[model samples]
Target: MKKTLLVFGLLLAVNYMFSQGCSDAGICSINHGFQSEDKSFKSTLELAAIYSLGEADVGYFSPYISYTKRFSERFSFTSKVTYSTAHGSFGTRSQFGDAFLIGNYTFKEKNKKQWSTLLGFKFPFTASNLKINGYSLPLDYQSSLGTIDLFLGTNLHYKYWDFNGALQLPIVNLNNNSYFKEYGGTNDFPSTNLFERKPDALLRATYSLKTPNKKFTFKPNVLFIYHLGKDSFENIFGQRENIKGSDGLTINGNIITSYSLTKQSSLELSLATPFVVRDSRPDGLTRSFVLGLQYQYSF
Candidate 1:
């Protein structure tokens, strides 16, 4: 039975390698509970590739590089950068996404329980407006949201279980162009020009199951996200209109599996799919599914 399950898991991971998606906003990238707790390692480096399929057949391919530095037993900092490309029927567009700088502070770690706080900043690298063939592309085709965002969150670990909560807020909004609105009556895309996005809150729970030899670990997690307020977009008449049904909840199920290759290196595979979705994702953050593969090195 164990061998059967292991083969099934491996097959699933390989099949999903071509897609990736998650936390449509920014909270999903905060490195909530995956940081190394081993004090012996002063720093670690990670390289990850992700593929996501969104509504309207839009596809995203993102490559990420991240570095984490352990300053002390209870403090650490992480920095990550991503380059993304979007392709679909409209064409292809690629650019640098947002950059993330996160700090984690542990408050307690005793008797198989740990508590930590997270604070981070998201710096935009693009204007969130990309043009293909002289046509404005939607948010799904853009790499960045073009906003300076603040992230605050907390994580609690008890034995093999993990719980996390977070909030992502835009401190500065720079996305104001009408994405694909210029194409107008010629296309079926939604109006996202001068898009104004709202804040999002996240909650996640996960359980880790490990093999007897400790070489393999499987983590299954459920993620919940709530859009705080309705998003708005400028209409052709030059008036801001609220996107109805935009403020709602989304629930997703995710699985992450890891294999230890050596003392200093490992490989991770993750897949995510939504169980519940909101009606209007005007921010163009909607994802049908996400898959990722990552390699990590520690020293």
Candidate 2:
């Protein structure tokens, strides 16, 4: 009975790691301890590929690259870029997505407790207005959300656990051109004209574990995101109407596993899925599941 229980516990941990996907805007991946304290390298570069299935059978593929530079023991900066391609029943579209620039500063450190603060910006590449044959596409089809956002967050770490909180606020709204009314009965789409998205508040907690041999690391995490206000859309009369059931909470679970290849290189896999979703997700951020593979090298 003891041996059987041990096997069952191991299996459970592995299964829960792949339960959900990671799409918490940009807060979840920052400050994940990619830098090595024992090594002299102060910079790291990462390349990643991600795949996810979205609403209406839409499939998305994104390629990502990021560079992190540690200026000091307590301060660092990261820059990231991504390109995305999406296809579904409506059509196919591809473009450069958003970019993120973040800075982190460690404020307090004790025996086993540490605290850090982060400030970041998300910039869009386009006007969030993609079209097909003169008709505007929905949010799901556009590669960029086309909104400038500011992120204010902080992190607390104690022993093998971490807690994070952040707020993502749209400073500028450039997503006003998505008009999905002209699908011509062939496709039943949501109303997303001149879409206005609200702010998002997030909270997350995670636990990290390492193998006895120190070659593999497992981190299981849960995330909560709450839409702060109702989203709105422009109608035919140029009046903005609030989208019903747009503000609510979404819960997601994720597991990240990494294998150390060398002193300065590693491979990581991340899987995520939603445990609970809101009523309306017209922003097209809904994903049935997300899988990501990443490679990192430090110098």
Candidate 3:
């Protein structure tokens, strides 16, 4: 089993795999580009449910809602809120994932090409507590990192293809308050522990097409990522589970389809899976499949 540190002070110290099930390193569940400047404002609400499993674990279920609004020809804003419930050999825990927000601006355009940059942040908000079985759960199992992070992103487009990337860097470092607690005042730990995390980055590209009849649109995406590592709590005997290999490379592919139910309503579905992996993943953290569905309307 390879070991490494997590980023929330590593991605929360988070990956939803949109991404928690698929990328987890903070790549969007759905790539929303610096779309063509059009409407004065547009809103999208997406509901996504995804599942994943590793070699040693059985499964995780994460359901979430995301909203985006384009305020003008060059600016847009987006946010995502999620709840994750994990099951299998590790037991069960349902907690709120962090809330992520982004503000994007398109700064350049030429013919059919456009470029934009973004700034983003994540907040520590949980729907449930972090500790389970009287000890702090590992980073992957918890939702919020209990700190704030900053994001920088850029997007470039040509014809029907989009190239985009982002960097997630934590400006604050703090650990769980319930990281570990002692029994009846034995060799003790605190209700809260302090930990440090780093940054994670992603690069992605895609090509899209529409049916001649204007009834359906399809997009295929490719994403690559490298997340930094760190060390955390020791085992029951106070041995830092420091095994190393927390950082690595991952390649993913996804196909997205949309069908219009009307002028203002539509149905969307997608499938994303990682087909390539290199280097040791921390604690057997392998790639899994993610399927999603979303309903959208605009006013």
Name the candidate that leads on TM-score. Answer: 1
Residue-wise lDDT of candidate 3 within 1-299, one digit each (tens)? 01211111123112324232234545554246355423633876667777666433546677888788888777889888877776654467787777888888887678987888888887767522366677555444555555577888888888888899888787775444334435413222222234444466888887777788766877777788776664344445645554354456677766678888777767778766665554444322344656677776666
lDDT of model 2 at residue 126? 81
Number of the predicted model whose lDDT against the real structure is largest: 1
Q: What is the C-alpha RMSD of each candidate to the true structure, in Å?
A: 3.5, 3.6, 8.8
* Higher-scoring candidate on lDDT, 1 or 2: 1
lDDT of each: 0.80, 0.77, 0.61
RMSD of 1: 3.5
Residue range with the least summed lDDT across 10 consecutive positions in model 1: 14-23
TM-score of each: 0.90, 0.89, 0.76
* Deviating ranges (above 4 Å) for candidate 2: 1-23, 28-39, 182-188
Better of 1 and 3 by TM-score: 1
* Better model by lDDT: candidate 2 vs candidate 3: 2
